[model samples]
Target: MFLLYITALIIVIFLLETVVIDLFIVRGVKPDFILIITVYSGLFLNKTTAETIGFAFGLIQDALSFKQMGINSLSKFLIGYSIGSLRENILSENVIVQCLFTFIASCMNGIIYILILKGLFYSEIEVLDFFKDLLIQSLYNTFLAPIIFFMLNKVHFNNVREFRGRKEEARTD
Candidate 1:
């Protein structure tokens, strides 16, 4: 049941980010819902679940995009795993923490993609354009992170164990 809910949510977000979000783009900037979900899941979910969702959604995103394949999956999967690993160290209910995570994740995502493009595909790249887009996208995502987290908080994910950001004998499941 949890998987079904998450899958459906990701599908809806994927559609929104790909199609509907085009209308809201401001200066070639838009929020990355996939990245937000990846981070949110990492904070509130189990390690394996967070990484699984991140990689799967990234793959779906890659399959549909025109850019080099595997880039999204690799970056997002790493972000998910890294964030999940830090749950214990960064336990908090603060919005700033979420924004910080979003900012870092967004930057990391862009940097990884650019590296892959340059190293693997050997694509011609404009340095200024890359930094501009990366900054805008990271800011856009960072600003929206809190709102997304708040909304997702309203949705009860009953079937998964939510790590309390620390080790405890009590089980969430």
Candidate 2:
């Protein structure tokens, strides 16, 4: 059931990503919704689970996306792992803090992605493209992060806990 929920969420995010806002229009950037999910999941789940989901989601994103293969996977995995580890120290359960982290992660992910792509594809990659995409995507994700975090937190944590308790009660019954 949890797997199904996550799958459904992934599908929704994927669809919204293409048709929703033209975040890239301002600076020509590419946003990774899966990456955001990985970060959020990592913050909530254990390390192994987080990394596994991160890698899995990254692979899914890479497979669906048109960008260079493996980039999404690597970036998402790293972001998820780092964020999950950071959560131990930060106690960032607040919505505002979560949003801030998401924004920062999104921005950093964008920059790192562009850098990796440029490094792999071209020796002399243009800086303007990197900066433009990074800025636009960061801003866009920042705006969207709060809403996403709210929704996900409700579904993944609240509903999940409810489901678990219900399941346990059913077992005892």
Candidate 3:
């Protein structure tokens, strides 16, 4: 059931990213829905589940992207694992924290993607332009974080504790 939900979410987000999201593009930089989802999964879900979702979504994005493959997958996997590991220590419910996480995650994703491309393909990325784009993308993702967080909060998958409690109750009974 969780897998099904994730699949549906990836499809919907992909469609929206390709179609509707472009309409709101500012300065040729668009909000990364996949990155946002990956971060959200990490912040809200268990580490294993978050990493799985991140890898799956990143693979899908890589397949659809014209850039080199596997970059997104690796970056998202790391982000998911890193952020999800903070679930116990961080105050994830705060809006500021969510935005900060999104910002940092977005920056990390951009840096990882660029570094991989540069190292593997000998791509010459201008430092200033790269930093400019990275900042823009991070801010854009941060701006959208709260809204996405609210929506994802309403999702049943976020209720992992309740599901576990029910299973435990059944086992005891």
User: Against the true structure, whose TM-score is highest?
Assistant: 1
lDDT of 3 at 138: 96
Candidate 2's C-alpha runs over 4 A off are: 19-30, 123-125, 157-173
Q: What is the C-alpha RMSD of each candidate to the true structure, in Å?
A: 3.0, 5.5, 4.0
Clashing pairs in 3: none
Location of the lowest summed lDDT over 10 successive residues in candidate 2: 23-32
Q: Indicate the worst ten consecutive residues by lDDT in candidate 3.
A: 155-164
**Candidates ranked by TM-score:** 1, 3, 2
lDDT of model 1 at position 53: 85
Candidate 1's displacement at residue 104, Å, is 0.3
lDDT of 1 by residue, 1-173 (tens): 65677778888878877878767597878878899989988877767878998898999889998875799999999999999898767753578889999899999999999999999888899967998989998998988888877777667433222434234434343
RMSD (CA, Å), candidate 2 to true, equals 5.5
Clashing pairs in 2: none
- How does residue 113 of candidate 1 score in lDDT? 91
119-144 per-residue lDDT for model 2 (tens digits): 88664657887676677777777676
- After TM-score superposition, the amount by which residue 55's alpha carbon in candidate 3 deviates from its true location, in angstroms, is 0.9
